[model samples]
Target: MTHVSTRPLEQSEFDIWQQAIARQFADAQVAAGLWTEEEALDRAVEANRTLLPDGLDTRHMILLRGVLADGTPIGRLWIGLTHPRGVAGCAYLYDIEVDPGFRGRGLGRALLAAAEATARDHGATHLELNVFGDNPTAIGLYSTAGFEVVTQQMRKRLS
Candidate 1:
């Protein structure tokens, strides 16, 4: 694995990151059957905006961009305290992704490590995240990273 590092997301990169994250999240929701194609984008945008009310300056939010030793962007991570003032000692991983072109290079695991460190620095004793049931790769990654399933939701579609 290459030496992957994380840095604060630059202001100039926010728009591109926001757009891509929203689109990817929307697609995932649609794939999981939790959203419709027509409304997914709107919902995604609103949900993100709601969580990131101050964008990069949002309280308790930690947004970082992962890069290789050469400074090439490979991925991004978003994490935050689950409660105000760190009362819960828990952090929620809102998002993490490796660029399609950069996948399978172990960057994802590096980003996860970065997230854990950042969350810990912010007073989080535990970290949690929600992955869609359809994302087996993410599930496997988290599982192998020592994450366990706390609960699950199941659905059966009928036509």
Candidate 2:
């Protein structure tokens, strides 16, 4: 079995990751009908500012880098505590990504375990995250990792 571990994300890399996440999250919100493109972008910016008031120095968020046993960084996982992006109180997995080269090696699964452990450490009974419906791979992974759907929204475009 391959072993994995988590460490605090370094500021240099976190900056790049944060910007990308905010934009992507905004896009996802638009796709899900949670907000219009402009609204989603504005909300994403506001949310990031509120949660990371001090940028990488914010204490309310936990930004972690997943590494292999030899100390190679494979991915990053962002979890929000003070401001759960998914639900009011439950810790939210704002973003998690395994390097393209590191995918399919069970690293993603390891991160889920680490996230659950971290959530539990913070007294949360469950962790919530939002995955775009089009990403079947992620949906399957989360399902196998013991995550169940809380609710869903569907749309039928009438021609």
Candidate 2 residue pairs in clash (backbone atoms < 3 Å): none
For each candidate, give its TM-score against the true structure.
0.92, 0.84
lDDT of 1 by residue, 1-159 (tens): 566789999877877889988998999999988899999999999999998999999887888899988999998888887743444788989889888999997889988988888889888899988999888899999999999997799999899
- Tens-digit lDDT track of model 2 for 34-142: 7998688779978888878987778767889999988999998888775454455688888889889999998898878888888789877778888888789999999
Worst ten in a row by lDDT for model 1: 79-88
Candidate 1 — which residues are off by over 4 angstroms?
83-87
Stretches of candidate 2 exceeding 4 Å from the true structure: 30-43, 83-89
Candidate 2 lDDT at 125 equals 71
Model 1, backbone clash pairs (residues 3+ apart or across chains), number: 0
Model 2 scores a C-alpha lDDT of 0.83
Predictions in order: lDDT: 0.88, 0.83
State the lDDT at 99 in candidate 2.
85
